[model samples]
Target: MQFRHSLTRCSAAAAVVLLGLAPGLPAAAASSSTIGVAAGANLEGISVYDTADVLNDEKIKDALSSIDFNEPTKVAVFSRQGEYSDDINSETLAFAREEHPEWISQDAEDYGDYWADGYFIITLSVEGHGDGQIGTYFGEDRKVSTSQMESIHEAGYEDFNLSRWTDGVIAVGAKGAKIMNRPWYKNPALWITTGVAGGAAGATGLVVLGVRASRRKEFEANLSTGREHLSNVTMDLDTTELSARTLPTGSRHAADLERRFADFMAKYRTLFARQQELEAATKKTRSSGSGVALSKDFIDTAQQLDATDDAIIAAAALYTRSATWQEAWRAQTAPILEDLAELPELLGGPDKKLGPAGSALRSFADTAQQEVQAVGTDLAAQVIDVDTALDRLSELRKQLTERLDAYAAARIGAYAKSEAEEKQMRAKLRKQRYASTGTRSGGSILDVTSPAEFFWRVSAFNIGYQSAVKAVNSSRQAASSSSGVSTGYSGGGSFSGAGGSSRF
Candidate 1:
């Protein structure tokens, strides 16, 4: 049975080889990665000298030998070969076939496969012409340049012809090290932004910071929506600016915002009402003189929580006619319009009369549009910031109320005359808390204050609440970092031999 299984495996392997070799079969192109496969791995370099020139140079040999490959993250020399080729003629190919027969075969493309499997496969060609193609055939998507080879060769040759053999080889080897060096895309923290269309996947790279792991599609969608929303808001503000001359008494936009503000007010009022009711009931229960006195610190903190609610409501009220996000966009539009005002003639009103200055005006208008778009983007960010702030407040209210309930129950338990009485009073307090607070939302609030003990006593409940707040803050940071358009060469990643190259 073992023999039969082996035969079947061999047959499957042979079929894969045949398929890979078929003429019409497409070669596997270089894979792209925003995060490179070998991002954090050390680079191992190899040099293949086909001519007697290198072998005859003691300095070149010493420089090559001096490199140490034992470090976790540096380049080091691997080997020097007399002749090299992409086909079976190269010593590297023979070694691959003999040692890693399973990994190397007729259908294998790019020597980087060997590199990936932990063997250094960088080949330095003594002669540039045939060696240039080595990367195309053996190295996974590594592009070898003949021009680069010639440049490095000429530099070495200038010294070499004058019997500066050591200088020449060292120069060539140094250049070769640069050319063969593997680029590590280790920037884990990447900023991604959405395109004008706002569809989730239509995002580009915008900013690079410290390394951060990313969930590509999900991140793209979120950033795109955020940008798209901002753009819409900007456009709305711009329209209002353009039509400022008109009286337009009742604004649909203002009304919509007003309704939202009202909803927010209602929610805040409900939270405040529950807080007062709990405070009064707990006070009444304590006054029974059952040896239960509520902590003054807790009461003060609860009052501050109520104050925070008031501040948030006040901010909403200030945006009665127009929100800051909208007003900011409107302010930006005035400048853009002023810049375009001179171009109205060039813009050719109705008659389509683009005069001699038409082209210049058109150019100016385009620039102005871009500036306006940028303004809109800023406004959109503001919108997100404001909304996130409100969400955090809601989270804080939920946690604060829950803590209040727990404190009340604990105090009532202490005051109970008997075990049955303690249980009855605690149950009644819990029911009253629920009736006043309603259902809870399972989300953490952002903790804006540091040294929380100044605001609230250090209780077990307070400690847990602080931990949850930290988690929320971390999540917010990650989300904010993910917002932007990613730009240039971060395609997910590709390999090319720009480090070094040569031709005979």
Candidate 2:
């Protein structure tokens, strides 16, 4: 069985070889009136012949017509001495010499008279043929081997055939015809059979390859799109959230809060300074209040202190709503409470050695202590509220970050996919170009087969369409978000008649 299989394989190979060797059917035969010429060059008793009869033959002429021959065609022939007669035509020889000046003659005696016998060579130059010209030569004697002649013919024929096809001719050879017409020959036909099977198989293969490439590209594009969307979302979310944290609820509200606090602090410091100054002034004044208006200065200082205390309370209320102040209060509450607790011990110590004005200095120290304690208590209560607010804000921020991160990741994926799809598209474009003959209606040099350009055009169109859809959706979302109303205070002021202030 094994030997039989081997024999079968050998027979198949032989059949294929024979099929290849068989002469292809000729198209139209050459006109009988078509003139054919033969020429030869002889030197040092060595002769070479050129003939046109083989080129003018029906099959040869048809093959030549399909090609564009722009260069001269050359061929070599080998034969024994009896193949040529003693009679030689000088006219044809002269024509050969005139037309092909580059034809060289070598001394046969130098090579032991190897190719000294008669040999006839044929060269064909078809006018207007750009690259296809067939030539054959037969020697008059056994000067050159048969292999040499076969080699020359094969080379010339192959060159002529390739050139014709390359020049944009749709000429079909025997192999092409068989492949196009036979369906059972294809491997797939073993399982699936149908009419137009060959063409269908070719087309299906092409489409399958194209679709596979397109799908790969789309997958890459989708990944890239996801990534980019994720990135954009992350960035936008970060920006908005950070802005919400940093930017005061309103411009005027922030400025007013700062201004009021600063003014109150300044007045409090001034009052304290004035009290010292008043003590010094009292010491410098005569027994009767003469050098300065003591009553007026004291009254002015008292009134300033009263006004500043009012402002401090108002500013503290406004500061309670601020995110920054809330954060600060939460962080500093413990330290502030400690400071307040230690103040009484420091103030009540025997070191209550008030400078010259003893009784009045003692009274001022006691008052200041009480005021600091009250302020501390109020601040501690407010810190609890601030901590609660901060907790909520932190939770909100975490949620936003997670959302943005997911979005950014998705966007990055999308961007990468888009880029990959582009590459796949490029490859598909190349395949498309190779599959088709990119010739225009007219015979123009502009005709081109470029897969790159085709892929780029297709990929670009898809990318643009997808991007437009995304843009529209994004626009709608933005419009919807913008439709709601948001209300906040313009500046630091009380919402009610009683001292209640809201600050962003």
Candidate 3:
């Protein structure tokens, strides 16, 4: 009875030791839960088999069938026992001895002292005997540390209790819960927040820039427009002043003056015809000695008529060259009238009444010749004055028109360039906004700082335009003054000569 009691105590102690080392067991043996083997606690006095020997251990497989291997198993076996009894089967003992020959005389030292402190023990038993052969299997020095072993033991206990078993096999393995963690770059929320913020900031900056650009463009456009208008006004004023300066003063009256001069010539020709008729009548009356006095009168009258005819021809030549023949007539007519009034008196006489009559006729002829010479000189002078005035007026008109036209064209071109530049700036601003935010903006696109700056630019352009206009006006005025003085002088000289000739 005492022997049986000792066997039971040994079995219980062995079971406790086996239980402690169970987490380190082979998978096949560890899966069987219906075996009659004792698994020990604390792994005390346990023997472990080599990996090769344990794989071929048939007795280990049979013993595992009777125990609850679903629970973590730990085993402790003694290498030495008291004298053998008949109940201890010789065949099993002999088989264990043959398989584990080195286990027979091994020292029973503390497993922790033999190996590292955290190393667990494994035992190979034959037929449920306490006197089983023991061998030690070293724990992995690189992987299995004391702290890791403790953690495994704790996890095993929890898993064994919670898991189900089927046909003596554990449903779950211990390694299932030992995985690795996730990295930081895969967080969608972080990337999303960054992208949104960056996009918003970029868009806002673009919008502000665009607004400023647009305002600048508008200001430039207005400035250009103002300049153009001012230039146009200036050109128009210049043209007007120029035209006034160049216009002929008496051009409209020229034709009428010419007609009056022609009528005066016709009258003079009639007087010449009357003198010829009187000479013919006197020649007929003087056919005998008594006719000698009549012959003298006729001969003198004929010479006077010839002089009158010569004066009329000179007058006609002056009228042909004058721009306004009426002016020519005025200058010539007074001289011709003076000669005619002196003619009859200069002819009054003393001689044979015939000699007196002959002297009277000769006097009339001399007076007529002087009058004709005076009329010719007056007509030539007046005609030359009229022609000079017309020529100067024509040249002035052409120069003024050309200058005004060129100024207008320049102003228009400048306006066009300014407008084009404004448009280009606006387009560039729009492109910048789109590139920054992937959207279009609805405001000005330029960078303008102040209203004052905007207005100043516009005012400057206006001033420039006004200045150009003033310059053109000044130029035209100068042309008018210089050209007008020259024309006036030339016309005055020509008219003066005509007046002097008229007095001859």
Compute each candidate's TM-score over C-alphas.
0.21, 0.17, 0.13
Report the Cα lDDT for residue 168, model 3.
10
C-alpha lDDT (0 to 100) for residue 75 of candidate 1: 24
| The best candidate in terms of TM-score | 1
Q: Estimate every model's Cα lDDT from 0 to 1.
A: 0.36, 0.33, 0.32
User: Comparing 1 and 2 by lDDT, which wins?
Assistant: 1
CA lDDT of 398 in candidate 2? Answer: 35
Per-residue alpha-carbon lDDT of model 1 for 388-483, expressed as tens digits?
Answer: 433433333343344344444444444444565555554444344333232111111112221232112113223333343354456556755442
Ten contiguous residues with the weakest lDDT in model 1: 438-447
Could you say which candidate leads in lDDT?
1
- Model 2: residue 401 alpha-carbon error in angstroms: 39
Deviating ranges (above 4 Å) for candidate 1: 1-124, 127-251, 267-504
Candidate 3 C-alpha lDDT tens digits along 61-136: 3343333322233332222231322222232234335674332223344321122222223222222222222222
Model 2 agreement with the true structure over 242-359: per-residue lDDT tens digits: 3323434444433443343445445545545644554454322412333234434444444433332332232233344444443333332322233334434433544334333333
Relative to the true structure, candidate 3 reaches a TM of 0.13
